[model samples]
Target: MSSISIVPTDPQRWPLHVNAGVHHWQYLDLAASTKQPQSVAEKYFLGLLTELPNLPVASNFQDASRNGFRFYQKLQLNDGHWGCAYGGPSFLLAGSVIAMYISETEIPAEWKIEIIQYLSNTVNKDGGWGLHFAGDTTVFATALYYIALRILGLEPTEPLVSKARARLLELGGATAVPQWGKVWLALLNLYSWSAVNPIPPEFWLLPDWVPFHPWRWWVQCRVVYLPVSYLYANKVTKPLNPLLQSLRQEIFTRPFEEIDFNRFRNTTAPTDLKKPLSPLLRAANVLLRFWENYIRPDWLA
Candidate 1:
């Protein structure tokens, strides 16, 4: 098994100067450095835990509160904040890896090791991942994570990769992934953008008073779709490579050439679809399709 160490940044001047109020930690392998954090607070708490004595339960509210503070205070950083591992949503990391792959960014060896470890740990018993670690498996996560691992240099025959591919196929393959998953695969040229429902950049130009204006969308939806609409309008796709070709063959139930991507744009996996597309939304997609075919302006695109 590979070895890793938790490395924390120096913080003597924390909450004051250039390094003030900043607390960061990194996971580095033995080759990078063997040094480990020697935090006084960590040592104190760890020692305390090792030799903790059972005493009569706190008799008063003050004693209980004080004891709780004493235990927790050691966990606080010099920057006057506590740290936590804030992971849950599974798509973000996969999406990031896809982006890096498209940009031809080389992933560090340590990162690749850690990423594989994380995926190995989180994959469901069914041999796929989910929207989160605890959720049921979905094509959206399984497909993207499968692609990410391949991009990280895992062979298709690798045990985990093969297992995930089986799960992806069982879920109706990559074409059954949801809208966002389609966009990501489309970026890598693994899926055709034409199959994707239109996200018109023109919507962003609509007045704020318009009921369905982009600005009227929830903040998360607004920010994400703004750039997504632009990409959709332009139909950006990476130049294909041998790996992409192999992935195309691997991810779909049918031959890549025979798979009608347009047919799958709206064909989300039953496991992944929380709610069916609304009739209004369906009608809008039809109009947008028509516009793309004839009415959409080249300059705007």
Candidate 2:
């Protein structure tokens, strides 16, 4: 965070030259952290820091293959696992934060600072964030991100937090958030358990021949849903911490008592429902609800 001083011989060109070098180093550091090449860093920064140009042509297949191998080399982690960037769908951070909290993992202060900085730097011009960095403002997306900031210990009354919370409340608050949002809020004790759709892990025990067995879903969806169903079946919630107490006010449109829990089981934010629900999926939800209330056994619970 050191400041740079510029001495300009030609005032018109000075700002451009100084700004270029400043951003070059900034992205250079980011590239170093991820083991990306200087050229890749330049391309990223120019799109934000300047204009982006078309990519250079590869002379032959061998040259292209060599470049691909170098890129893969950069992604290799020291511990032998591969490191990757997961950038789409910003709501993933909320789940990650909640999982870490539930597992009693402490996030480093430096990471907290960078997380805040990243959010601040990327906020939309109207003073809210979106579902993805490139998406439009959304209730579920903005609310969850604001909640994450609060959990990281920002004051509710902080200007950025207040603006985001106000936007969320205006957009119909936690009740209007999607299914995933409800689950995260419930785990944090910000919303009631009844607000969420039933997710029973015992569903995992169903025979492979069962048409709706959990194994038949896409792998990413099934794996995360498995743990989530286990927690939901047990009604797992962290003991009410002070952050949870404040979130009760910060995230809701109405008093906690007035929210109609049953009304929102199928509720999803407009931004979240870009794809229409399939008839098959809707039928599955109906069956899951029936099982959750009447058929799930005590042994399973």
Candidate 3:
């Protein structure tokens, strides 16, 4: 069994930042010092559960419709908008946690506990996580989330983490993560940058009208890879420590030093591949790799 509650506080005064139409919410564990109000949704749900102990049984479409709207109305915010947790794409939190860990940022106690609880609760029966809540487990999610739980202070020998480790190794270890996952692991120094195909920043130097110019890419793809290209070009990595060193050994099937990372440069676990690479894309990567090793200039990088 599990429980959750709506965080009730002044969004403006606390950690909610709104600029234009964007909203960034941050959770803080300001125990005792701050007054937390009860949300209308919380009150409504609590009262509803109390009154209908056996649960409400809608006898008709009209009854269900009215009940649904009544519950939804309680969720509307005072700002005239509705907000809910972004519950899809299980990999996003792993990315955020990795970023925080590399930057030495401290997660608030409340958020940290909730993050751990959520990850633990969502683990699949096979002891791994998936791309989304209902999706099957893959190396990408399993490897990243495994590292995240470790960084959050869970012991490697703990049941949840040990199970994930067993599942990750069974799927060919962290080396089996997709290209995007490779970049992230490289950023943390868990995977060698050489194991990743080129994400050359030089691509940005090309004219916007060029057929493969990053500007022509879909906005979401462009925005993500824009910074990644810079990092990849510089071969940026967090300074190594005992924890990272331990992770290196734990996430791999073979000893870290004995593994041939280059062999996995273009490799992705079958479970993690959403789409097969096209012939054109494969040729482009080969050409890019050649340029990276032979022709790319340090000044441009």
- lDDT (Cα atoms) of all candidates against the true structure: 0.79, 0.68, 0.80
TM-score of predicted model 2?
A: 0.74
Instruction: Estimate TM-scores for all models.
Output: 0.81, 0.74, 0.81
* Residues 1-301, model 3: lDDT tens digits: 1122323343322344345536565554566226654455433422333232332779999989988877677666657676555756966899999999988998665566667877877999999999986789999999999999888877887788899999999999998799889998999998999989889888888988899899999997899889999899889999999989999999999999898899898788999987887888889899988999888776775
Question: Backbone clashes in each candidate structure, one number apiece?
Answer: 2, 0, 0
Worst 10 residues of 3 by lDDT: 1-10
Tens digit per residue, CA lDDT, model 1, 1-301? 1222323322321121114645333444444433554354544432333233343478899889988876676567677766544467887889879988888887766567667878988999999999999999999999999999888878888888899999999888988889999999999998888889988888877777899998887997899899888888788899988999899899989999988888887888998999999999999899999998898788776
Which residue pairs in candidate 2 collide?
A: none
lDDT (C-alpha) at residue 148 in model 1: 91
Q: How does candidate 3 fare on TM-score?
A: 0.81
Give the alpha carbon lDDT tens digit for every residue of 9-87 in model 2.
2111111112322311231233344564333323332233323343356799987887777655544433444433464
Candidate 3 lDDT score relative to the true structure: 0.80
Task: Provide the lDDT at 254 for model 1.
Answer: 90
Show where candidate 3 strays beyond 4 Å.
Answer: 1-34, 41-80
What is the C-alpha RMSD, rounded to one decimal, of candidate 2?
9.2
The reply for model 2, stretches above 4 Å from the true place, is: 1-64, 67-82, 276-287
